[model samples]
Target chain A: MSDSRVSSVIQEWASPFPGQAHTMHPVTSGQAESTGQLAQMEMMPYGQSQLMMREGGEDRVAEQMMGMSYLSYSSSCIGNAPSAASTNHHHQSHGNNEQDFSHFLLPTLRAPLTKRSLSKDSAEYRLRRERNNVAVRKSRDKARRRIQLTQQRAMQLQEENQKLQMRIGQLTQELDTLKHILSQRHMPGSEEGAAGESRI
Target chain B: MSDSRVSSVIQEWASPFPGQAHTMHPVTSGQAESTGQLAQMEMMPYGQSQLMMREGGEDRVAEQMMGMSYLSYSSSCIGNAPSAASTNHHHQSHGNNEQDFSHFLLPTLRAPLTKRSLSKDSAEYRLRRERNNVAVRKSRDKARRRIQLTQQRAMQLQEENQKLQMRIGQLTQELDTLKHILSQRHMPGSEEGAAGESRI
Candidate 1:
């Protein structure tokens, strides 16, 4: 599926196709017939792998393609055991190019399922539904934690503000009393002065 | 309080207290009485601003203290408008060290108090509480999203797996048919020419 891998596969297929045609020797009739059947299956348009390459170094592309092809073949062999012989024969007819056959089959194996598979009773349909349920549950939990942290911080700030206000009030009251005394002192001469002079 | 700010404050307080001692000064009788009242208030220790200094920093400390004292006296004057004269006299009597007094008062006045205010007034409190509520809501939303994403991924994987399984089944069926064909071809005398050649 990676661009490099696809390109490498395309290269492998393109390089070997002509060579294989020239090298073909008559095999036993029965083997040849079986091989023909396999070749027919490999040639199936929809199921055949089509490599799409992008510009990249050949070695790197080849390595990627090889890995991808290996995985595809393994999967196909496991998934389509009945077709294993035919698929193998198809590979042989293509002249022992493991990469070519693998490239050919990989795409078919990875293709999205058709409507028939998406219908009820298909395993894929059931799995998709179950996965959706799990994702919903996880998203809900993440949101809850974020909300809790924010609320805690807001409460803390509010508490601090209240304490500062109270201190301000107390300071104001003391200041008022001081002002009252200053006003009384400014008034005309009074007995209070005698006492004040003695204290001084 | 950040650690650095706290340590700096502590250092200032630990240093020698600045300013001359309280000295009795001659005053008019009326002024004297007012001073007595001011003294009484001061003695009660209604949060007198304490002077704190650090070594080798007299000029800076003095400047800062002067500004702070002026601010404090000005604010007190505003609060005690009726007795401004008495407050001014008191400020002068203390070596007119309004600067020192202001310095002591600034920090106390600046302390934060939003939290305390919230508790006293329901309207303000409700506003803050509402903000906290929003945080909780956001948290819940995030959790939901996380759950949804996870579920989606799981569904995709499951769907892929099912497709692979189906492909495997198809391959098995094909292999069975291929085997049947091969078996039939190997039947006795199926190819007369080949059979004769092999027998010879």
Candidate 2:
């Protein structure tokens, strides 16, 4: 009866504390190869169960020692209550699932919470936000200034082009007047020379 | 008296035809060198003399042949007439100056005349003017199209920026709601667990 109680307590702790119990299980010669394979798996990068080993190593060892005493008490309860092991396993799994769900939700929830927790008056966050705001404002102002300058430059170019076109027109007109005067001078000279020669 | 009248006729022709007046007095080596130098000067690119040479080569040469015969006659008519050699030199220099001025003005006047003579009906001139007009029109159209395309591109980018800003705002709001729900769930669960343990 005592041995059955002890086995029930071990089974209960094993289900919840897989990492510890799995590591502590006695290895017989027949199970040596399977134990080696399990150890290899634990060393892999995907072995998240090993993470618990890194935290509270000494405290967990002490707890495990204390758990032996608790085991005796639980075993007494278990012998008297046969349904206790399965019920505890069911509750433990449910608690673990809830914990996993909470872990998954934490990061999603943390982002906005951290943003909200940003103290309105704190210098660090306020200064950073203000710096970003100032940079944006300065860039907008610079862009506006550039646009105005471009418009001014375009206006200046247009005025210069108009002046050049006017100058070209004036030059063209002057050349035409010069040509007309030259032709008039040539016609009289040629006509008088012809008449004089015909009379001679 | 007949010889004197014949000499008068010959004098008139020779006065205008310098090249043919060698019989009156053979062209001195110095005068010939000067004449050759004048011809070289007349050939210069910017001078009016070059144009007269090009336009009246045959006429001027014929007049020069007549002037030579006239100079011989003039020498016969009045043995006291100015030295044929000196007379020839003076006339050549006078002709050089007149030819130079004409040559200079002709080209200056011709360039604009050519432009003016481009009648709206002349195929070759019209084609050249039309090609220039087409090039200018194409450049203006290209510039206008480029400006329009740039404006359209800027508008598209602005629209995209606005959409991104809206998406960021929606995501931020959703995160805030999720965080509020998670915080509420966590607080009440801890409180209920404490109450249940106390009751137990």
| Top lDDT prediction, candidate number | 2
Worst 10 residues of 1 chain B by lDDT: B60-69
- Give me the displacement of residue A183 in model 1, in angstroms: 99
Best by TM-score: 2
A38-104 per-residue lDDT for model 1 (tens digits):
1111111221222222111111000000011111121122121111111211111223222322334
Query: Runs in model 2 with CA error above 4 Å?
Result: A1-122, A186-200, B1-200
RMSD of each: 49.1, 57.9
**iRMS of every model, one decimal?**
46.8, 58.7
TM-score of model number 1: 0.19
lDDT string for model 2 (B64-144, tens) is: 011121122223211222233212211222222222223356664533333332222244343564456446534444433
Pairs clashing within candidate 2: B10-B70, B14-B67, B17-B63, B17-B64, B17-B67, B20-B68, B21-B68, B48-B103, B48-B104
DockQ of each: 0.00, 0.00
lDDT of 2 at A84: 22
Q: TM-score per candidate, in order?
A: 0.19, 0.19
Off by over 4 Å in 1: A1-200, B1-116, B120-123, B152-160, B175-200
Model 1 chain A: ten consecutive residues of lowest lDDT: A59-68
